[model samples]
Target: MRQSFGERFDVPDGYLNTASIGIPSASAGEAVAAAVAGWRSGAGRAGEYDEYVERARAGFAALVGLGADRVATGPAVSALVGLVAAALPAGARVLVAGGEFTSVTWPFAAQADRGVTVTEVDLAQVGPRAAEFDLVAVSVVQSADGRLVDLDGLRAARGSGTRVLLDATQSLGWLDADLSWADAVVAAGYKWLLSPRGVAWMAVGPELAATPVAAGWFAGADRWAQIYGLPMTLAPDARRLDTSPAWYCHVGAAVALPWLAGLDRSAVHTHCVGLADSFRAGLGMEPAGSAIVSVTRDGAGERLAAAGVVSAARAGAARLAFHLYNTEADVARALDALTP
Candidate 1:
């Protein structure tokens, strides 16, 4: 029998801060706990962690609808974005959405010394103006206010020969979209994927021709065998772009990701968005069709905290996110806190 989402997580009522960090499932928590216990007792083998890394890589591939060979493991999205930033030709024009998370924009912006100009446009305009730029980098969902990108517009822009790089940090776990067409896709595992910090993944598409500038031993075709070699030999696929695995993080992710991948994502999306819309309606706002809601009232952050409702303050608003573990009671508690 399948465990209910509520059964999988022991989240307390009034906890609504999934946008900042996710509560791990009971199984994942136990796996990490056991791994830590082994480490503390000097009973853990480093060699065993390689399997965990591979399992996590494959699970993320399944979630994003890609092959494991196209996915590269890393510790941070910024580091993976740096790999792509370094591959751009001198004088390349990069288009980015205004207010995009710096991890997606700063990497390309940092390359200005090489004549790589990163131009910021309204989030809505990124796709229509894509043909004018060499590359378009943006998040699947904006981090500040939860505005969704116009994916169809980006798809049309791809037809015009503009390469697209998407940061799915906010959307991957709940947003169901076919991302295989993009030149590259990157995500941090901690926020929505329910993994501990230090685990991330990047998918390199056929259209992206970026070289692995930060290749290390983990990037080798046979990393164990290539540990001490004069000539550097890297993996034939995206693994060549990998940073060394953070073993403990992967151990938890190996259990969490595959379990998440097996669930009916469409149902999960509906549950989350339904809760978010209910909260919006409570505040006399129309449904935004996103799982995240930003309340901009004065002292909203303090009020939520006072009411014991967990949320994040970002861009001058109190941001509340709904996930599978959240329920209607949480929305009511937050509304009670803010309205009264």
Candidate 2:
């Protein structure tokens, strides 16, 4: 329907692999290129890059419906998850979906020696069984098959006293949902966000009072002024948990994220899901109501590739994702390739 956002990307005709990696918007790509050129000529100022980080941070905060102070910049979801894991008391119990991305589950599992236990159950069971665990960590959308978790169910679980941590890596850019209720929300920028690698974010809710266990100079109250200090004073809010940012990545994100946040996300979501449903219809499958579609056909990945339809193979299925940059043409190309 309203597919005007597709013009922002410069991808090939059949590029449908947003789940694995997104092609950056033309503006974002140009910003990164210009920043690199400035760096090459020694014209870049390290201090100025902090502004880019702040802009990206604020943009992500707006996207998730949280105050910027509640958000922290990071390198990856796993690193932020590690911070949450470290904060858990000994013998804490954590629940996660069976097929959740490892970044959200593995950190809690690694605390096995601390008497902490990580349990995997069906995604549907995550909310129903939330009362059994101290915390529930899961992805908002499953990376393997694009299954959407029940946000209302998670909200009810959190109200019943189970702390929740959500990984929004595969859902944020297109899935419009207010995530203010979760104890922690983390997302990697490279996938759905169309940002460069190394930029990620975490938003901390009032339920989780996590300490900055991996605090560095960037976590200081006045990072630049307090860089060389012994009695470290971290920011009062979520910035205390910040990992040192990857400057160049933030430079691109500074452009991409705010621009994305400003767009009609509901339209973006509809456009993506519409393309996915079109593909499903072409394959004679029911509409899945998700932006990402995964089909378990023999040699589906190879066939799609041979037809110049870019996609990914995950969990023994060919995973095709639709983003704002995709259109009906992409769905047709992918369907033609997979059709018998």
Candidate 3:
């Protein structure tokens, strides 16, 4: 690992598993430590925690090109999906792919209990016929194959009545996504966002953000005031959808999300894609659009790990993901390891 990125991570020998879990930057770790200390000493001022949550929301908003008021914090992508599912029109016809990440599918599947019809479609057919369904939900990138979805095509295919939801866990930090086409978007923070687990965000379009739902104590208009048995009213914005998260996650994300926001995302993405292409070329494979490269070889992951590289095997394909922290040397080591 080279020092090109200015000490972002204590680089492992050859880490290519950002898709599974990202190595938090040094700044993020420090933020977490400080937050833990603050909690331990009980020295946090009033509204200090809210300030941290707001900072995270603001950072996520900038990343996705939405307003901070439109972004809500959640515990996980799965829970955010359930919140989105709950707010959908009754008996909605939801379209999804046959084999999507369960976080993207199970929310709608669970909607079966609410009389919502869940229809699975082939990935190819999804774009052309999206408007036919009341809701279309899919991942921005396929988790197994690292295939990037054509967001522009999907946007073009949608009708006035069609609502598009994106599970962007795989591409949010590293890829440029146009949220203009989505009614809602959810992402887990532990992956590309470069934070720890148990932190997630969901940004809703204006219409969805304004809708009232059955919310928890955190979603109350005045949670502290209502603690004295005062009348409760839901928050007026995306905060109403928030599921209370741990203070540590909020602290870490407040630090990490800004790191993502401060990046030259275009340059980082280009570098990652170029590295993926180099990896594929080394493997005598074709080019890929995203930073993920998949190869069909049994035991490839184990072999790479044994050779001082880390990777993942999913759906019978060994997966390699390159991020800003990765270097040409890392790619070369992985290539040499995989050469067998």
RMSD of each: 1.7, 1.7, 2.0
Clashing pairs in 3: none
Q: TM-score, each model?
A: 0.97, 0.97, 0.93
Give me the runs in candidate 1 sitting further than 4 Å from their true place: 1-3
Mind giving the per-residue lDDT tens digits that candidate 3 earns over 1-340? 2454554577696899998988888888888888788878987664578777888889998888888878888888888888878776778888887788899888778878768998887777777778788888999888887887767757875645678898888888888657645888889999888887998998888655323344677787876665445566767888888766677888888888877888888887888889989998998988877888887877788888888888888888888888888889889999988886
Which is superior by lDDT, 1 or 3?
1
**Candidate that beats the other on lDDT, 2 or 3, i.e. the better one:** 2
Worst 10 residues of 2 by lDDT: 1-10
* Candidate 3 Cα errors over 4 Å, as ranges: 1-7, 41-46, 209-214
Give the Cα lDDT of each candidate. Answer: 0.89, 0.90, 0.81
TM-score of 2: 0.97
Error of 1 at 271 (Å): 0.5
> After superposition on all CA atoms, how large is the RMSD of candidate 2?
1.7
**Which pairs of residues have clashing backbones in candidate 1?**
none
Instruction: Please give the TM-score that candidate 3 achieves against the real structure.
Output: 0.93
lDDT string for model 1 (71-159, tens) is 99998999999999999999999999999999999999999999999999999899789889989999998889899998888888888
Residue 216 of model 3, lDDT score: 70
Please tell me which predicted candidate would have the highest lDDT against the true structure. 2
